[model samples]
Target: MKTTRLAAVAIIANLAFATGTLAQDKELGEAVTIELNAVKSNEGGCTLTFLVANGHASQIEKVVYETVLFDSAGQVDRLTLFDFGTLPPGRPRVRQFSVPGIACDALSQVLINGAHTCEAPDLTDGACETGLILKTRTKIEVTG
Candidate 1:
């Protein structure tokens, strides 16, 4: 009877730990939303102007943009990384990045990966800043 009780306790403890880990993973997996306005297709590739507003919490420090371009078939054709600098609390910023080798006709969607790396600001010593990861999905229309 004692052995059975011990086993049950161990199982319960393991389950608690597993639940906590899963929650953390889910938070990290949540996608960030990015709005791309006025996307134009040129002769060579495409140009996109985007803005991120209230995309993160005040605790967030640095965000890294991992962009993946997909074709109409839903196959990933290009992957690009844009490192966005530090973000201040409650401040909105706009940035632009060009996508090369992407044809307007073949373009389907753009995936933005936002990775939050919250650390102490080099200029000032402070407490731990929370980090965030965001992924945005946007559709594109081809115009000849």
Candidate 2:
């Protein structure tokens, strides 16, 4: 009887682990990656087009893309946000943002808000903020 119970418990544990692993894999596969293509310098402001690709198993609804610009002095000069409603699975979306008074060389960092929470990261005591004005690709999971 003891051996039989232990066997049953072991099987249950194995099944649970497998299920968790599969769920994690699915979530990871459903993430969306954003790639910065080009930043055009206009006379009035800067135009940025970021390529966003969704790999989720399901469609993401009501997605908002925001681009926060930081200057060379590490201060936020402009914040431009765009709302791109629904993004179907395996589709690429282009989001544009215009930042006024943002010079090409003066830019130090850019933040692509995927969740749209707009939570400010702690930047105190010489600690670097979450993102800086540089060309980098980051993934924001909109939906699972």
Tens-digit lDDT track for model 2 on 16-52?
Answer: 5543443344433535555564577889777765555
TM-score result, candidate 2: 0.55
lDDT of 2: 0.52
Question: What's the lDDT for all of these models?
Answer: 0.51, 0.52
Best by TM-score: 2
Candidate with top lDDT is: 2
Root-mean-square deviation of every model: 16.5, 18.1
User: Any runs in candidate 2 off by more than 4 Å, and if so which?
Assistant: 1-28, 117-144
**Local distance difference test, candidate 1:** 0.51
Residue pairs with clashing backbones, model 2? 30-56, 108-132, 108-133, 109-132, 109-133
lDDT of 1 by residue, 28-124 (tens): 3222334454466877888775544333344335656566777889888887775555555334345577777777667777765333333434423
Which TM-score value belongs to model 1? 0.52
